[model samples]
Target: MVAIDPEPLLAAGRLAHEQLMNDACTITRVGPPTLTRGTSVLTPGASTTLYSGACRVKPQRIPRNEQASERLTVVARYEVALPFSSVATDDLQVGDTVTITASGDTRLVGQKFAVMAVDFGSHSTAWRLTVEGAT
Candidate 1:
């Protein structure tokens, strides 16, 4: 049996996924707020762009009983997937922010989110990000 290269196959799969269901997303680095004397100032930082993106943002799914019993405030959680070539995996950290444009709604543009986790597949050309609402 001869060996076959998987790079081309992976690239094709990524392309198909991108073209079919991807949107635009921006990942911005979060830096510590600067403190001057006795005051603290917060500001936005540098950001990188991803042309093809997959973002899932919705309210946390929990049983109504459980939510009420625990007094759990269900907030929106975001999961974003991007092609491996878009940005370096190392550049995305837990504190980074991701702003994604809603696919069909212009009124929901630039929804902000905070990165909670970053998962990179060992053999896949994609990055999966788990995020939550950001202030």
Candidate 2:
């Protein structure tokens, strides 16, 4: 198994927060829910249904301060994962970019962003995103 140092990890995390404030774009995208999965079972002679809702877009948030500390208050939340999926069980990485395709009549067609604070998902794969790029 690969091993990583605790010191560098903390440093990188702190750095990400700091880097976010300088040139980061925090955006919030809301998407509709879709059927992510389905299961069926028959007991006796009855059937039942179940439904789960997921977020469909990636939301980004950058720190408001360049000198913000990694002490909870200095951090923000973002939805970086495909809402069409389940919960995220991985941590975010550095230098990861996700391209978002906007669907609307607006001028925004093709836009790409760099994830800075995934805080609670596998890289840029979460219910939200905290990116630091121009929209």
Model 1 C-alpha lDDT versus the unseen true structure: 0.63
- What TM-scores do the predictions have? 0.65, 0.32
- Candidate 1 clash pair list: none
Q: Model 2, residue 40: what's the lDDT?
A: 43
TM-score computed on alpha carbons, candidate 1: 0.65
Measured on C-alpha atoms, candidate 2 has an lDDT of 0.39
List RMSD in Å for every model shown: 4.8, 17.7
Q: Note the clash tally of each candidate.
A: 0, 10
Best by TM-score: 1
State the lDDT of candidate 1 residue by residue for 24-105, as single tens digits: 6667774554545555555544455423355434344332322556576545665677765665555677877777765555
